[model samples]
Target: MPRTNRNGADTKFRAFSDQTRLRILHLLRAGELCVNDLVEIINVPQPTASRHLAYLRRSELVITRKKGSWTYYALAPAANAFHKTLLECLGQCFDEVPEIQKDARRASKLKQQGGCCPR
Candidate 1:
């Protein structure tokens, strides 16, 4: 199979197709988070959270960095107008989603408590 274009909508849409991936993306709209934070906020297993995050990384929708032994993730900055619009839409589309809203609340509280990893 041919490699999907990182900038192509097909790759991104495929990544976004999963409900877990969407929840992760929605939570990331706020700021950077650690894998542990995502596991806690999204209430998923660590491997499951890592799997979705890897998909997002392949889709080029999220970026990562390291601080000590922890990896942090954040929504990647838009690389084009299409990506810009998609990210904008992502923010607006999920406000009324109860599951994501609950994730957001938990994420907020986690942040206030200094998160699951050191900054």
Candidate 2:
């Protein structure tokens, strides 16, 4: 496959195509989190979470720092500008869609309460 242009919409859309990856990015927006946290929240194996993290790191969307045995990941400030804008637009669409609004509320409650409602 040809390499995607760094500033192209195709690259951005490709990055957000994977549901797991998108969830990981969303969670990272809230705060820096370790691979384990992403694995838990994304309900994926550690290796899978790590793979996505690696891809995001390579794309410059996420940055990581080693702390003891753990490596924590966070959204890179420069990378997040586009994502933040895109998510804000999506947020508006979700607000306009009642079903999406309900789902978002339910998911937020689950996250706040430390529960993973089986997908």
Candidate 3:
């Protein structure tokens, strides 16, 4: 059981180690976003975006909420001191990264346009 928990933590940290996943996390900092919005903002194919989201879900770093036909993803609530600090660090550290910045801009535009996915 101890080993299982440790592996879970390892998976969480590993999720942060990917550039695409990190960009996805950075975007989630804004609020919950549907997969379509994520694909549009990150300029990735649906499969690629969904793959990253699945990784985050496996790591327990994100939670999903279904709203009608669209599912939205958001950062999971901090589970412990470590998780809290990691999320805080993610928000502070990646806010300035060029790629993340570009993602944020695109996300903002998408939101302003009332989202890319149809209701």
Q: What is the C-alpha RMSD of each candidate to the true structure, in Å?
A: 1.4, 5.6, 2.1
Which sections of candidate 3 miss by over 4 Å?
1-3
Over 1-119, each residue of candidate 3 has an lDDT whose tens digit, in order, gives 55566326687788999988999988998889999999999889999999999989888899999878889999999888888888999988878888988998899888889997664
Tens-digit per-residue lDDT, 27-104, candidate 1: 999999989999999899999999999989988999999987889999999999989988998889878999988998
Best by TM-score: 1
Superior by TM-score: candidate 2 or candidate 3: 3
Residue 81 error, candidate 2, Å: 6.1
Please list all clashing residue pairs in model 3, or write none if there are none. Answer: none
1 against 3, candidate with superior TM-score: 1
The deviation in Å at residue 88 for candidate 2 is 3.8
- Stretches of model 2 off by over 4 angstroms after superposition: 79-84, 87-119
Which portions of model 1 miss their true places by more than 4 Å? 1-3
Residue 64 C-alpha lDDT in model 1: 98
TM-score of each: 0.93, 0.66, 0.91
